[model samples]
Target: MILHLVSSPPQINLDLTDCVSNSESDATLQHNCLHVTGSIDKETDSRQFISYCMNEYSPKWNIQSNSRERKFTFVELYKHNITSRHLYLWSAPMDVAERYQFYLDQLSISNEASMATQLFYNCTPPRFGPICQYAFDDYRPDHLSLNEIIHDFYLHGYEPTTLTCYVHLQCDRGPAPACLDWSEICDGKVDCLDGGRDEEHCWQLEANECADDQYRCVNGQCIPYTFFRDNTAIPDCLDGSDEYFESKDKRANCKIAESVFECEDLTCTIGHRSWASPLTSSCAQSRSDLLIKAMFLHKPNSVLDECWSAFLCIIHGSNPSDTICGDFCVGQTFNHERKTVRSSYGIKIEF
Candidate 1:
């Protein structure tokens, strides 16, 4: 069936809501009833014919009209060859199997049985639909498409169930762009260098009483009593709370038996003892063996940093007295120390 209409153009408004409502339930137009308009220009022709195929076309509309108006406009230069009608509307048969497959994909279900099972498990009373994707927004009747409803269901249904907390190891904050480690929390220093979050609420740690063998750091961390005021500038506490009395430079100026020792960057202990005080001095003048032993005590697992520190000692004319430094520094081992360095991929390597 063809519906003939005349209009003046630059544009023509077409309303098919009435026609579709009045049409037979099984009778469908070739053009999708939901959208029934085509473009034509005044230069082409003033009169335009909209053709509709009746029984030959199958209906694809999954919605029923409840007096809702469907209006459309046809406007634009006529680009195609002139034909009997400006617009041909045809009906298409809905492929049940294909439509079922599409519904399966949208619901993320393999079949009806699976969908039913999921709906049963995930949905509670008064919530009925595929995957229990419906929410009560007030009990009101409204026109909505199946696709739109399914999309809303998918959004709420497939949301992540596991909660995650990401830590950004920056002291300052704008965008984190990084993650933090849980172990870094309350370890002593400001782990979140930009924001110093790890150092937050550290005073709370002080409330705990320390044992006789433990020395309490300012941040409330307790360490071996021997580690307290042990002449090393490196604070056993991450916050450097233990070294507040003397700075690295001040400690470097100490006189050992009337010999003034000034260290440029590195700090070392004089004796082979792990708990010995750190004396700042040039790597060449410091005892390399003692430095290595101290490093091992401070960071036992940090083989890479230990080797690197040993190399600096060797470069400064101090012998490491062992091939372990050579084995690690020369790539004989693949262990990494991320504490002191970062890989090219931005992975933190603690030495």
Candidate 2:
């Protein structure tokens, strides 16, 4: 049987190759201590470390994984009954010893603390939560230098320091200085509050093709594009990107989000009889800031707020509310934006 005698200091490794022998009559069998050398292969090193913990730590280890698992975790390091997890990286037994020293230094245990270790790295988190994994082949002191081993560890998967959430996701920016949460990203909420910076680039157009009676939205959602071809119908795409002006008139039969008046500035897509008069931005963020501050001459007692005068004020650096703002609005006419009522979900997917 092959028995591996684990050395007291893990840094040293030995493999004892032996043969059975006996002394004969009038013959003295003299044997010398055989020196067996071994290399600290990472895969074998992990097994040896596991064996050491299982055999030495025993009950305190509380390991439930079978021999094949090769992974284990230790909890309850700092607080009592508090749920917490950690990911740590280490290079050597001295590194492990330093981590233990950190626990003591942080008052996890006092100087008079027992020689018992309370917790460790294990197979939890389904995947490694926050981790520093080294895929090094071997870390034998006699075979490789410290710098060389560390180089291998770095090449495998060692970070110089802790990575932030955004950095982990490789996002352009985080919600705040150094905070990043994977859950908050791409959830339709602007967690960063930086004008949807966190949500940017979370999705992209992959393909576009729709079956009959289905309209493909710019967002890749398939809906009814047109009920009847050759009809003056506005598109139902939420962004109105599907609607195209024919013959340069910039007018089309389009299904609009709301029945609203169009602005005198043909360039502005936002129309308002008033649901949007008081508001400057909408769900699509299509409202123009310049229009909101433009000189609006109130058409008092007019039918359906028939029109508002967005007269270009001549007064330099003055707002539409300026006393002289109306002097310039004499002939300006802002037309009421037109739109058909919103249509219902017109198409159904066929499984």
Candidate 3:
């Protein structure tokens, strides 16, 4: 005798009976039967058992088995013709001959039944035809082959057939380029089946142009000017976009000193000489003229001398004659009295 137990909610009680004649002469009958020995609670429903079966044992039953005596059974109890939930059982008869034969037939007929339930247990039904079904909005299957679908199912344990079908349909119908290919398609140009490339195309310029205070188009994108460094004397942008141009010698109408002393044309001694004499002389002449004009306009003499001297001190070196002095007096300076004496004698004295 073999015992098979099927445990599920809304428990079903099953009894197996076999009658044998023990003594031929007396015609005596012997009865052997299996009965449900344990009581089942009604509250332990089929739904809970089905959930457990699907979660716990589904993966184990996915493999193929060659044994006949071992078989798995799934049963659902019903109330008023509606199946409440499902239950599963693993059974093998102690009578090896009968058990082996039954299991062998079961294995041959339904190898993937358990696995299929597990794979599709939580999956939503496909809502569209072959080409319109997909698991996610952006996912499509037009490019996936049948072999790919089987491989995906085996590896991921999910059916992506509907997704693949939808993808293929879109590909055939020339739907919008999938989001995955946006980079390739929108590479500064428009590439879509609907002649909608213009809407998607954009340009991006390099940073170098912005640093130059210039607006430029690079790769179909407009780049505005920007400053790269602060406190620069010259405008960074040749186009004058970064720091706007004001007067010819002044920017923003802030008076700028004239750049008259270019180093290239200047000789070493002559250069220093000009800095002391000619430059000083020119500055002095301008200051004297300004003072005379101010005095003619009734400006005070006190104000005139202070302003004139201060102006001369900046534009001319403090010791204006030092550059033209002989080797012994190269860096020497005369006192005010000696300078007055030299000027009175018409002497070309150097400081």
Total residue pair clashes for candidate 1: 29
**Residue range 1-351, candidate 2, lDDT tens digits:** 111122212122111111112323312222211122111332321211111111122223343433422222222444332222122222222233345455556555455444335433332212211121212255443434333343344344322222224334444322122233443454444444335565677565335667877876554556565532322223344333455533232222111212121111122123411223122212211222222232232223421321222222332224666655554344442232442221011111110
TM-scores, all candidates, are 0.19, 0.19, 0.13
What's the lDDT for residue 191 in model 1? 34
lDDT of 3 by residue, 1-351 (tens): 122233212121111211233344423222222222111222211111110001122223333433323222221111112111211121111232233344345546776333211110111111111111222232234413222222233334222111111221112112211121211222332323345442242332333233354444322222344432221333333222333322332221111112111111111121222231221112112222332233223323334333333233333423454332222232333222322111111112222
In candidate 1, what are the lDDT values of residues 1-351, reduced to their tens digit? 122243212111122322333345535333211221111222221222233222322333443432222212111101122111332211111221123334345544433333222111112322322222223453223313322332243334232222112334344311222233343455444435355776687677868778999988654678888867654433464334455433433432322111112122222333321222322122222232333333333323434555545444433323544565554455443354433542211223334
For residue 22, model 2's alpha carbon misses the true position, in angstroms, by 97
Better of 2 and 3 by lDDT: 2
TM-score top scorer: 2
Computed on alpha carbons, the lDDT of every model, listed in order, comes to: 0.34, 0.30, 0.25
lDDT of 3: 0.25
Model 3 stretches with alpha carbons more than 4 Å out: 1-149, 152-185, 193-351
Clashes of each: 29, 14, 12
Please give the RMSD to the true structure for each candidate, in Å. Answer: 30.3, 28.2, 38.4
